[model samples]
Target: MIGVLVTFAQTGKFDRSTLAKIAGELRGPFEGMAGLRFKSFMLDEEGGQARNFYAWDDEEKARSFFTAELVEKVTGIYGAPPTIEYLDIVGFVDNSGT
Candidate 1:
């Protein structure tokens, strides 16, 4: 599995509602993405940040979302370029039983 962490740091003061909007807007496009096993949306009001954590069965498919154009678009909205980190998944425990 491939683990990707994408975080957007707000370049200014913000509120909880803004965080909610960020979470919704940013996550909308990647919902039900191909090769995505699972995704989690995160918001940190005090930290003024929004994040998306994804588990992918295919790294190539995950990488496809971080195109240069998309990066520019995201930066336009977030006020700063997003910090994207790709990590190896040594192990994961899922008791959800889906």
Candidate 2:
């Protein structure tokens, strides 16, 4: 399993509703993706940051989704480049029914 973490500094002009909508727009299309096990997101208002946890079968599968179009779309909304961290998950517990 692979994990992708993204942290962003919010512009502060956007409200909670807008943030939720943006997150939905970004993640909704990934629902049917193959080799992608799951995704979980966290947003911190105090820190003005966001994190996304992605579980995939391999690194190649993860890269395939970070295409030019996706990058453009994301940068257009977020304004600044996000710091992404990729990791190999050794173990986990999921009550979400994997």
Cα lDDT tens digits for candidate 1, 1-98: 88999888877755668667876776766677678888887776778777778899877887986899988987887677889999888899998988
TM-score of each: 0.78, 0.80
What is the lDDT, from 0 to 100, of the residue 29 in candidate 1?
A: 61
Error of 1 at 22 (Å): 2.9
How do the residues 1-98 of candidate 2 rate in per-residue lDDT, one tens digit apiece?
78777666667643567678777887877788799888876677677776567888888988777777876767678775666778888998878765
lDDT of each: 0.80, 0.74
Residue 14's lDDT within candidate 2 is 39
Backbone clash tally for model 1?
A: 0
Alpha-carbon deviation at 65 in model 2, angstroms: 1.9
